[model samples]
Target: MSGPKEPLTRESLEPVPIQVFDDHMVLRPPNRLKERSAKRARTDDGGDRTVISRAENALKLLSQEFDAWMTKELDRLEEARRTLASAPSDAAADRFYRSAHDLRGQAATFGFPIAGLIADGLCIVLERKSEISDPTPLIDFHVESIRAVVRQNVREPDDSIGLALVDRLAVMRERALPA
Candidate 1:
């Protein structure tokens, strides 16, 4: 043979090694194409080993603040209910809706997902404020449902009563929707 043999195995079908071309051995660049282009694996810092409990305590304190705020809102809701029962006007509806809407928006943040659901139900029912002829009972029921949740300290999504309340609200919303 006039030249060095070319490897002919099926595995040898790949392009010639960049390190070896013809009779000349090529010097590889210190930084390789693959090494330069490859991404390094990532791992999370996983954060402070000692302060975790402290952080949890801080969260508990914050949650207590939210709980207090929610309690005050519920009290306001009771007043709004009385007001609506006395005079069901857009102005009164606006106050009631704001209370419900505020609770719906914030209750979940303080570990009261069911309260949020019931409040959301009230918000939905009271949406067409002027259209509702007699919304006091429905509003009172939703407000009381949320109050029951807080009273029982019910937070689990699958809690039996909570689920029933959520289902009822879903049905109410569905019924209210235009078919």
Candidate 2:
């Protein structure tokens, strides 16, 4: 094809002297050049470093405190349930439900999903029976179930069964309430 069209060559395509488009055009070095780390980076001062370390230490302490608080709440819920079993009164059931609700909130925050879910369901059951029934066996069952769940070290609450039970309890409570 006509000697390959002279290889489609360009006369000035090779490297040559740079030319300015205008008189005030300042040349800029390529931005892709590697930067010196010392020029771009800062050395951490002892004060700033210590502040960060102290913040981390504070967070660790707070986490430990929160864990302890959650454990105490769990123990309190267990005790309240036991007391309800012995007395079998509306006030006792109410106290047990309140304790269980607190335990559920704390356990959920602590990532104990199994305990949280069981406590949630138990709370609903207690609320429904708070005014009239002797809810000792139910309270004991809930306490044991929660203990077993805690022993198993569950990370997330299983909400399906708990939600179902909560719904049933809600309907029962609605029917029992004054018209």
Candidate 3:
């Protein structure tokens, strides 16, 4: 009875149709107007789009230089730490100070603001050594900061990460340095 309770099928469950526009049936983005505009800006060779090519080359050079500088600075920091750990002499402290100073200069030159700040902190701490009562704390702090610099660079491709670490180092340096 009542059409056998009307079997519920997919066709019966379907909703009403919605209308959508289809003006230009062209495929692949219809490069009509913009393609002509692009053609006007080309050279005879039509290979390197001048402004874009220059910017790309500059970026490549910067990336290469940044990688090279980072490697050298990391090596310098390692050498400084090793020297400090090996002996109890002013010479080791001096080496650490020089390395920190050089690193700061180079980092600044490379636009790595954070690395520069960290280098400044390390330099200030190392410079205060004149027969330190306990050099271990200072040495440990430098080691940690150096490790942070290396880690930050590895984690983030941007040099600004160095700035964040340096900001932290600045706070630590202020609290740790003697009057």
For each of the candidates, give the backbone clash count: 0, 2, 2
Best by lDDT: 1
Best by TM-score: 1
- With candidate 2 superimposed using the best TM-score fit, by how many Å does residue 2's alpha carbon deviate from the native? 99
Encode model 1's per-residue lDDT on 23-104: one tens digit a residue: 8887543444455466654456354543597788888778858767878988988898889778877788788778888999
Better of 1 and 2 by TM-score: 1
TM-score for each model: 0.61, 0.49, 0.52
Looking at candidate 3, what is the lDDT of residue 155?
36
TM-score ranking of the models? 1, 3, 2
lDDT of 2 by residue, 51-153 (tens): 7999978876777676567678878887887787678677877787788888777776665766776687677666665554655555566677677666656
- Model 3 C-alpha lDDT per residue in residues 9-128, reported as the tens digit of each score: 433244544455586333343444464456644356646677688887887678767757766876877777787788746787777678788877876555455666667776776776
RMSD of candidate 2 to true structure, Å: 22.6
Q: Candidate 2 at residue 112, lDDT?
A: 70
